[model samples]
Target: MDFSIISENLHYYFDGLLITVQLTGISLLLGLIFAIPLAVLRTSRNFILTMPIRFFVYVFRGTPLIVQMFIIYYGLGQFDFVKFGFGVFQEGFNPDNIGNQTFLWKYFFSEAYFCALFAFTLNTCAYTIEIIRGAIESTPFGEVEAAKSVGMSRTMMLRRIILPSSLRRAFPAYGNEVIFMLHGSALASVITLMDITGAAGIINARYYAPYEAYITAGVFYLCITFTIVWLFKKIEKRIYAHLAPYVDKTQKTAAVN
Candidate 1:
């Protein structure tokens, strides 16, 4: 109903969208980087290594992401040791001076962006580890055996055969994970990060126009979702191109002859 407000706040909406994208990109990158090792650990034959990873995955996956975020952001701050270890407080740190520090100094450790990034990265990594573990496990045993038959070392077979095939099989699921991360980044706003959802909430409070602000944010999210889907589809096609069958008329003619 209020087209003018939407137009006037378009720049704010765009800024929020940028922040949302940034959070998602950073979190997803960190998650994937950590996930490979965790997945490997999960699949390891060593019970000592496998059990911890399995437990981590269970705890992270079993809990609601919101609860995890709160635990990291608020609950962790309750402990003096955690605060000190995370650099949230200096030696002999006193809470009374928290508000008097410069913005950068005060937020150096307790910033919403970092907290959100930490929470989302940890959560995404748990999910990605399971996905990657499944992909690795699903790699055809026969192929591994064939590689070994050719005198390939375990490392060589893993690097040359297993990882590549597993990557291809994992891409589709990873793409979905990417999209999920993007959408989940909206939660960053809850911790006061001015992501798209946060900006919408702020603008709605100021303008008393929740519908316009939220709808605009929703549209921004939809655009991001579409873009991610399209990009991943392109990646999937490129990666799996070799799997496509090529109909060779020349071969057919030679056979007939």
Candidate 2:
């Protein structure tokens, strides 16, 4: 109801929007980089390799994201060992004479940004590994055999044949993941990150205008979602173009003649 309050703090809202975008971008990039190897492991024939990957994916995917964030931030901080580990007391390190030693760790590393990033990265990786595993598995068996027939090594076949094909097939699903990550970044607010949602909450509390603050946050999220969709469309068009049917006019003419 108070347009004046919303207008006054527009810069804060924009800053929060930027923070939200930054978190999503960094987490998505880091998560996918970690996920590829995990996906490959999931498809491994070796039980030793496959079992752990399966367990990791199962546990993360099975739990709620909020619970995971809480455990990483609050739960881990509760342990003396985790807070001040053996590594902190390594030969060259000394905390005894330092003033406010624990204060620095709690303030910087335990901040909501780091905690939310950690949780979201793990959660995204779990989901992405499954998508990648499915795509890799769906690569045609005959193509792999043909690569082998040509004296291709396993490494060569995977590098030259399998990965490219699988990536193309997986693009659509991966695009959906990108959109989901953008929306899910809102959860970072729960950990006290001043992202769009968190900033809106702060503004609403101050002005008692929940409707306007929340509406602004919702608009920011919508903009991000649409932007992701547009970018993915461009990438999909470029990547999948080769898969489209070719007319081959010369071949048709030759057959007719």
Candidate 3:
């Protein structure tokens, strides 16, 4: 296959890759922000506290990411109130025909970039919350008792023991979410976001060399995935370093036996 197409369009690919990374990073940050509180609430025994979180998670997790993006970018435009009410950039903002598409509700809900960011963030939050909640539940009862025995208050126990432990335990699953979100950000192209996938699509369209165009995108994706995996491994090693001694001792004991 002709790999020249990729080199010729390197600038486009670079710009697209940057956009993709920006979208993924912002969405992941927002998802973490939302997920933590929702996850804490998810661990609650109370129906009132958990039911809303349950419904939110169910809706987001059940829907396809593309559909969510469409709803945010296209479907919402159908509603006059949503288009005009939430939309800002009032200067020369034509509230009459949103079909002209001036504003998209700035901060995190406007235009292609913000809408894509908002949708992905919500989608990631649903999955991340579940992972974190599971980690929280998995925190050992013995550990809880140990914290209590040390005269640790509930707040102190949560701050010093539960949150850190849960985050450490959840890292692997959360790392997968990061990779998935990065891959999924390609959908931003559907809304004219010009992300990495969009750049690939442009190259393919221009050169009519689908193989060359897509192969480059695939390579970029693989590199990002590997980088994420490496970072996660480093983080896991550092976070779980305390368990290394126990693990090594156990290995030695098993070998001796």
TM-score of each: 0.88, 0.87, 0.87
lDDT per model vs. reference: 0.85, 0.84, 0.87
TM-score of 1: 0.88
RMSD, candidate 1, Å: 4.1
Model 1 is weakest, by summed lDDT over 10 consecutive residues, at 80-89
Q: Which ten residues in a row have the lowest lDDT in candidate 2?
A: 95-104
Query: Which ranges in model 3 have alpha carbons more than 4 Å from their true place?
Result: 86-110, 245-257
Clashes by residue pair, model 2: none
TM-score quality measure for candidate 3: 0.87
Count of steric clashes across candidates, in order: 0, 0, 1
Give per-model CA RMSD: 4.1, 4.6, 4.7
* Superposition error at 218 for model 2 (Å): 0.9
lDDT per residue (tens digit) for residues 1-257 in model 2: 66788789988789898889988898889989988878877888999989999998999999988899889888877755455554565676554543434654556456778888888899889989999999999999998999999999988998898888887888899988888888888888888789999899999888888999999988888888888889988988888778767767769877676
Evaluate residue 214 in candidate 3 and report its C-alpha lDDT on the 0 to 100 scale. 86
Distance from true location, Cα of 232 in model 1, Å: 0.7
* Model 2 Cα shift for residue 13 (angstroms): 1.8
- Give the Å error, residue 253, model 1: 15
